[model samples]
Target: MALRPLFASLWRLLCSLKLAIVLAAAVTLLGIGGSLVMHFNPGVFGDLDRMILGRWWSTAGSAAPLLSWWVPVGALLLALLCLNTLCCFLDWARRIRYRWRKGGEYLIHLGFVLVLIAYFWGSLAGFRSEGNRLFVGQTLALPSLPGHFLRLEAFEPIFAENGRPVDMLSTVALLHGDNLLARQIVRTNTPLTWKGLAVFPGSFGRTVEGFAVHIAGVGRTSFSPGAELSLPDGLRLRVLNFLSDARRLAGGRVARGSSELGRPAFELELNHPDGPSWRGWYLLAEGPPSALTEAGLLLRPVEPLYRPYSILTINDDPGAALALTGGLAMLAGVLLALVSFYYKRGRGDRPEVW
Candidate 1:
């Protein structure tokens, strides 16, 4: 018999629009209090709760706290839904009295409720972030979650003349395992996405390339530092030359772009004759051709290549729908109650009947 009254009271509370409003206000106040506690105490916000009239708030009260925040959020949403149902009741009551104005007021409130629910749904699910940092030769670990691995092939940054550190770029060599994945030159605005996760370009310069030493001198030599050449048909050519922007007497002089690589043409050995063989002195990618012993040679700019990076995920929820439904309902109630008790309250079409 005692249980029956208690159940009845619980039902009445759940069916009350007033209760929903109070809780909503309480949730907001709690949020502010939480912020204040975190701001003032700094330490206690981690886990603390004081008096009740003060709007009781607690953390990790359950057996396991850190593992769940969803429970509390759900409870709040449920309370909001009860309020929505109450609003629906108000509309039903007003409609029986042919109060269209009151109904319209309630509908306006419903729209915002839907929006809130969507937000919650969006918040509770489908979101995650995880990745690792690595040097050029090193590989990135695949996330613990289901997804492919994105390897850093090379990372380069473009800087302004003043040198304040600007954009970062990564030449990524992706991988699934021993097998290669996608390879792309990634920079700002460029992202590599797969399995619902996205890899954006982060800061750069932590790689094997960072360890490279620059060597420049006035001389043409066999092979500047780069990958040694390999040929399909037969023999291969090693890059045999490079100098700054300069030339010398038949005896010797070297010129590379605008800067002299210390000295000019000294000596060079042709590494290959085909493919990368003596192309042009002013080439872009594989540098220019070599003129040593009239053998086919290639000139290459010694640019140390490397890769580095990190990864960020944006994810999707089901309960959010119910909360939205409830919120909309509650809003409708407030509007109907407001209009029926005021503006429409005095309308001539309004039945004198209470």
Candidate 2:
């Protein structure tokens, strides 16, 4: 009974419009500060996450050297703002007289509340995206979902005139053990979405696929397209041309065309890195990538080079549905509020309709 006056005072303070305005202004200022901090110190937040939360399944904290301190502060202020909005809404409802004109005001408040709820829900339950690079016949295990993996079947790169890459595509299959659940052709703009999980084709980078040479300490080095090698024996090797698709011309001649993945071949040149003193072409795919000697070194091509794989980003948003519903509800509430305000003003019942 003694706490009744204290609760009433707290409720009145929370329901104050001035408090809501102040919170809103603070949120806006914090947003501006965040943008500025991100612009100046781009990797500050990422570094903070890595340092405080570790690499995989990362979270963020205030250990960052720069401006990441605003995150928790902003979040707290936003939560308080939501509470203030809710309090104001309840206060408005309690003060309103039962009338049709008051419907618009109720709707407006409800919409704002729904929008806030959606954002809060998303912040709490939304998914952080995961990225992976997959090659042909390679399987990637899903981190978030157990007993699920995606396999890369084929990756094709479409080239325009003069061998300029235009678009890339990947055929991927999601499977649980031997059971194939879904097969999708993921492209740059076309994403594969299944079971609330969306898979998007990201960027691409070269991978040394086939002929790999195990040089002592240096894991596995392959003769890929645009590859340069500096051997420990003071010799340099450079690949001149790699033809994954080539056509045999008239007499003992191998030439590449604009179309088709024919016989794979490579034209290489070995030289001293310091100066272009000794340089000779080693036609590997034509003869033997292994049995070659221009630098007097037994640098052999152990395997073949495969097509570059595409980077894929997988995302799942649990609160997406809630966010969408809340957004639509908010919009409808705004429209209802406007209708009520206009209808009341037309009848000249009140000059200012809150």
TM-score of each: 0.41, 0.61
Over 270-340, each residue of candidate 2 has an lDDT whose tens digit, in order, gives 66657565433344545544324434465455676556777888865555565566677667777787767
Worst 10 residues of 2 by lDDT: 48-57
Candidate with the greatest lDDT versus the true structure: 2
lDDT score at residue 295, model 1, on the 0-100 scale: 40
Q: Show pairs that collide, candidate 2.
A: 210-303, 210-304, 211-303, 211-304, 245-262
What number of clashing residue pairs does each candidate have, in the order they appear? 37, 5
Q: CA lDDT of each candidate?
A: 0.47, 0.67
Question: After superposing candidate 2, which stretches have Cα over 4 Å from the reference?
Answer: 46-61, 89-131, 162-166, 175-183, 211-304, 347-354
> Tens-digit lDDT track for model 1 on 202-297?
454432221122223222333333424443345454434444334543543334434323323222333453445443332333333435323433
Off by over 4 Å in 1: 1-15, 40-108, 119-124, 130-161, 165-205, 210-354
